[model samples]
Structure formats: structure tokens, C-alpha cells
Target: MLEDLLLQGAQPNYADNIRAIAARWEALIPPARLGDLESGDLQAGIVSILESGEVTDDVILTIAGDLASLSWWRGPPLRDDHRARLNALTRARLTRLADSLEMAPRKLPRSQLRRSHVLLVGNLLDPLHSPSGGAIDYAAALASDTAVSRVEIVHSGEVLPAMRTYIEARLGGFPASRGVALVSTRDNPDFLADILSRGPCTFHVWCEPALSPAISLVSRLGPTLMFTCADEAPVQFADVYWYFQSEAHIEKVWKAHAAPQEFIDRYVRILALPSPEPRPLEPMSRASIGLPEDAFVIATVGNRLGVEMDEAYITGIELALRSQPKAVWMVVGGLPDYLLGAFEQVLGDRFLHVPFSRELDRLMTTVDLFANPFRAGGGNSANIAVGAGAAVLSLSRGDVSSLVPDSFIASDPEEYFRYLGFLMDSPELLAAVKAEQGQHNARMRDQGLFLKEIQGLVRLAADRYEARGCGAPLSTTVFAPLTRLAQAG
Candidate 1:
């Protein structure tokens, strides 16, 4: 079946398969770096395996499992018994593969790089899963705009240089004809340096860990802007970008991460969009849900990255269920397997663990309230979905619940219970809140303010280019309105 699928031109899960294979074939060097193994330097191990006719999912998994079973230690030297076992096995396997491979090296262009008016630098290297929904929305709108000429995005995540080069070369054919191409983080410093050397504008949209480095680098480079979600002490630089802070909490950098007062004075804008047609309520089918109909349905969505288990989330659900004993907790973004036993021991039958599904709209509509008991991660956790009219309950701290009204902040279990009680007891209040939330969400969709913000940033970058005489050409049409606004003064 799998072979037939492959023959039909289905994309193989190549990278994931390679990682496992590398771990198994740990021959003194990292298996991942095996692509560097030189049989006269013409062919890499990964290339050899892929080109080999005998390749199958089962074969690869078996090979990787065998390799993994033999090793315990990581890094360069092999002193321990486990390391020796892994190293000996790995070398033998690679030698066998090298003897079998008859193909010669293929030469390719380094990268068919293009330049863009907007250079967006992201810390996320994995193209498939970097830059969250918000970032992608911003990128799509900026690139799609008829006014803007070009956009180049780069990404990296444990990917090989050959793969990175290949993807970037393919990116040369991406849309946005007038714009220049910018580099995403491709793990190759030479590639990054090349773009920086050639490009006129750069904007680093950073999340948490990226904040400090982004700030430092932008300051050093002289023509860069750092936009971050971190709330630490702000670094003085050319400009800072912030979002509309909800009344729930405050950050230290609110005042610090700022552009010059002159820049602020230079532009003023207003936004108003036509009302969108209303969407109707989706019907709830109880049997479709596993839990009892009377049960309080607590739902949460997350990536499962942070250290804290969002036990406070468990507590929130428990509290709600206490008020209504039949309550069942439906969780998306599956919990860690290790913690599953513990969660079962505690929450027992109440916990319903479900893998993260793309059909979130249906799930959100089905749940009583969308709970985001996040202790970590950047940006407003549930804002986008909640804006789409998914009833949300989240932490008052940080960006997650910021846009939520004061009435929505659940500092303690008791406060949460009261709110939950109020929600259940008063259908009118629930309907009104959902309606208001829907309106706010509609505003978000209509404004496309983030795109305009990026445009503004691009203009700032262009002015910097002009000052430096970089002459990196940009779209005059996009910024024409701003120019007019200035001249009208």
C-alpha cells in the first residue's frame, strides 16, 4: 500500500525518517550529520538511502529502532559500553551502504535568491511550523497586497543545508513580482550574511527567547526594527512595536519599546469597516460528544511545550465540574504520555484526551467555554479563536487573556466558579458576551491592521535605506498615501 502511495507521487516523510535512521546509525558522528559522510564526497548517506530501491517505511523504522536500542550516550567520544555498541554498529551499516551506492554527485545552484521590499526575520527555522497563525496572517496579507511588490520568508528547524538550499532556490519562484526576496533563518550564516549585505530593509518579528537577541542585533545593524511579545526591560533602539494591551495586566516595556516622538507625530490614522453578515449558531449533537449531556464540558487547546502541565487548567475544569458533577474535560494537543497515568489517577473518567485537530471551529462551538490555562508561550493565547466567537477563559497574566474584559479575568478558582455559575445561570449574559466578542472578532478580520503596520514598518526601513544611500528600490505606490499625508501638512 505504502509503495503504491509513493509510486503515485505521494511525498515521503523523509526528514522524520532520516532523523530516526541517523540516531540508529550513530557511527562516531551524529547520524543527522551522516549526510556529510563522504564516499569520495559525491553522495551523502541520506541521498544514498533515498535513491536505494529497497527503501520502505517498515525497513527504515526497523533500522532506526535497532540503532536506538544499541546506544545511550550522545556527543563525540565513545568510552562507555553503550556508546561503543552504537558506534560499532553505525560504522558497519554506513560502510555497507557506501559499498552499495553507485551514484555520482549532482551539482546545483547555491540558491536562486531574490530580494524583497520587506525583509521579515524569524527565529523559527522550520518553514512548515514556524511563525504562528498571527505571524502567517501578517505575512500573507503583506505579501498579497497589490500595493506591496515582494516578500521573501526563510525558516529552519534541524534541516540539512542541502535541503535548505533546495527550498530557498525553489522560493525564487514564489509570488509577489515587484518585491525583492529576503532570507528566513536557513541555519547557514553565509546565506543570512548574503541577504543582509544585499537587502535594504529588515524587520525581525520575535517572540520570547528571540526578544533579547533581536533587540541586540537590530541595534547593532542600525537599520533594523525589533518587534517582540516579551515584557522585560526594553532595549533602546530605532523603534519598538507593541499591541493593544487589555486591562488585565501591564508590562514594563509598554513605555520603553517606542519609536521617536517625531515618528508618532508624523502619522495619524482612523479605521472603520462595513459590518459583516452574521453567522448562525451551529446545532449541538450530544451523542457526537462522549461525555454525558449534563456534564460541564471544559475544553483546552495548546502545543504542550511548557514545563507546567497547566494543572491550574485541571483545577479550573475540576471547579466547574464540582458545580456540575457530570462535567467532562476534553483536551486537545494531547498531554505528555508520561503524565497520562497521573492525570487518569487524578481526574479519572472526567479527562478526555484528544489529539490536536484542525477542526477547532467545530470543537469550539461544541464546548461550553474554551479554556486556555496557559502558563507559558508568547502572544494572546486564545485571542484569535475567541475573536471568532469561541467563548474563551484564560489567564489574566501575560497576553493570553489581555483583550478579554475585566469580567472575564479568573484569578482564583472561586472567581472562576462564580463566572462559570453566572454563565450557566444567565443565558442572556452568555449571549450578550458572545455577541460582543463576535463583533470584536469581526473588527479584527476587517481591519487587516497588522498588514498596514507592516507597510508602515517597511516605509521606515526605506527611509533608513535612503539615509544610507542603499538605493534598494521600494514601492512608491504603497507609501504614496503616507507621503500625501505628510505633504498635506
Candidate 2:
């Protein structure tokens, strides 16, 4: 069969395979570095892999897996079974590779054993660069962990000048040797390959459409445990998922999406990540964003990052804005032109756009209330609003419930509308809700919820490591002894 394909120029030789792989691999690597692959270097490398006298199944399998992962961003484009074939090969060859290439205990110093190396593949790298609050905060929390030895951030796209400074201070400032590497998947995906190739320690991901390739590829390589922070439960690719709300709500969402009950039971990890308590949001007014002093500001967050929005949602906002004349909808963050235009048209001068800010926590305090963005949902935006002591109102429930005030959770659309109208009619009712929310916010911050979740994740990851029989590993968890390290500057 191989001979026949070659006869008709179906494959031709190893060079064709390398070329085809390299073309698709463009998506995975830095655009600038891609020239070398097309200049015959990639094929030459492939030749060496095939001709090396000491080649093992692991060597071939690694190449196959890389190509498969690069090509199958979603699952093969059409009939290209490259992903499936490579996955099977990698799994078959993994044990042999893991056993032979395992890092020795003696070689690792005692200090190294105290911490776990975490490779984070997500949108975080710099505040000025991506300005994504969720990823940046999550990375900050993990980096602050005393038990974390190395936190390698795998980011993509532009790295502005400000990004470098932010990383150096927040992430790279860690005391651990080789503490942080702000890696670009485009510039050097090799660092990621090197880590995963070393054997599946674990891959933690925030499941977004953009990361489908990375997540799918990681699934192919060995016995890797993937912990995902996904608002919606994925049908495949992730191993364990961290959901930011109650089990009942998540179960309802999963079942609504047709996720099997067994799958949900096996994979979901209900972890209501705690709110980040920065210094309390300083006082500001409607004048901060060019609105009237008495404008009843309704705050919301948005981004061009493809947050889900529907027409019904547009109607909800339209109704919210029209319900009261003083209602000014202040959106903080970038929005698609269409949505932005819709808001602008509906509210005219009453709509305010504050370009996404790093200090959004402080800015959110300026608003009267944070209306959870209809069906789109909020990430750090909702958290900051609630943490800043502003009441949050959500029409549709999902993970957004984790951050919103209990006094403001609307049961259905009719009730949601009624609540909005009631609040618009009665100033006392709105102020009381906001006050109750402030009390709850104070309690949440005092309890340290976000930090606790990170600590819990470290403990869980450590448990998996020890159970793997990978020597009696020091717990990569925060114990009494490690408390000093946690408090260490």
C-alpha cells in the first residue's frame, strides 16, 4: 500500500510528509520562524529521524504526534487521519519513552524537590499586552505559590514593551531559580514540546476555542492529566475541569449541553475560585467616564475575545437601558464593532466606553451596579465588581453565579426584567441590595477564596504525582513548613 501511494505521488517520500506537516505546523509555531522549515531544513530533519541508526519507536512517535497535533486543530480537516494515527502511535510508544527518559531523583537537588514545575498554556503574559484579567490573575496566584518551582507561561501573539516589564515584576520576580519563562508558542513552541516530551507531568488549560490545538495535542501525548478552567463542559480533550459555581448549576448546564451524566461525574471539579482582594476600590463617580453626576451607572465588561452574545441578550440590554432615562450603561473592555454600535445607538450619549483597563477593579467601583453581561458572562470583570463591593445582577446563570450577589440573582427572564424595573423605580431597593452585597464581599475577601483554590490544586496535583509511584516525592502542597515560603518576599 505504501509502495502504491508512492508510485502515484501520493506521498512520494519522507520529504512530502515533512512538507505537509510543516505547512500545517505553521499554525502552531511563530510566523517569523516558519521560513526555515520551508527552506528544506524540516525535510532534512525528517530524513535524519528516519535514517538514524539508533532510532526508537519513541523518536518516530514524537514526530508523528507533533505533526498530528499541528494538523488536527479541531479533528482532521476532512479525511486526514494524521491526528488519530499519531495519537495511537504516541500512546503505544509512551511507556518505553517515559521509562527510559525519566529524570533521575539524585540529579535533582533538595531545593528543586520542594516545588512543582507548572507549564501554563493560556492568554496571560503581560497586563499591557493581553490585559486579560482572568489569565493574568490565575498566573499571578500560581506564581506566588511557594511550592511552584517554575511557572512557564505559553502565550501567543504580540509582546509589547510593557508586557516584558509586567512579567519581570509579577511572574519572573519569584525567588525560585529559573522561576519564570514568558514563552511565546510562536517564537519557541519547542520549550512546550520539551516539557511535555519529558513525560506528562500535567497540562493545565483554560478551555477556549483558540487553545483547541494545544489541548488536543496534549491529550495525545502519554498519560498527561489536563485540568481545564472551562465555563462550559467540553465533550472531549480535557481530563478534569474546574467550574466556578455550584454543582447543581454546573450539572444542569452539562445536561443541557447533552453531556452524559457519567462523564460529568468523572471529570467535573466544582471549584468556586475566590475573589481577588486588591486594595479596596477608591471612590470615583459617573464623571470618571463622561457621564452625569447623577447618572445611574450600570457597569459591564466585554472583550473582542469572542465572548458569547445573542440577539435576545441585545434586547435585554436595550430594555435595561430604556427602562430608566438616567440609566447609563458603562462598558469596560473592548467590544466587537457591531455590539458596540448597538449599545451606542440604543443609549446615544448615555453609553460610555472605557477601553479595557488593567485597573478595572478600581474603575468598577465607580459604577452604581454591575449588570452581568446578559448571556455573554463575565470573567474577572464580575469578580472585581463584586470584590469591589458593587452589587452584581445576572440574567442567565452559569459560572457567573459564583461572583454575583445573592440578593440580585434573578430566577427567570420575566423576574430578571421585573428586578431591573423595580430597581430603576426604587432607589432604596437598589442601595440596600448593593449594601448587602458589600457585606458578602467583605466576608469572601476575609476568607481568602482565590488563594485557597490554588492551594487545593497544588495538593491535588501532588497527590497524583505521589500515586504515580514516581519516588516518594515531597508534597508540592502548602504545608505548615511551607507557610514561611508563602509569606517570603
Cα error, candidate 1, residue 420 (Å):
2.8
Give the least accurate 10-residue stretch of model 2, judged by summed lDDT.
Answer: 471-480
lDDT of 2 by residue, 91-192 (tens): 323322223333433222333333434444454445532233345455666666666656556666676666666555555556755355666776775765
Candidate 2's displacement at residue 417, Å, is 1.5
Error of 1 at 157 (Å): 3.4
Q: Give the winner by TM-score.
A: 2
Candidate number with greatest lDDT: 2
Please give the lDDT score for candidate 2: 0.51
By TM-score, how accurate is candidate 1?
0.56
Candidate-wise lDDT, in order:
0.43, 0.51
Off by over 4 Å in 1: 1-116, 119-133, 158-175, 180-188, 196-199, 208-215, 218-222, 230-238, 246-286, 292-295, 309-313, 337-339, 345-348, 374-381, 411-414, 457-489
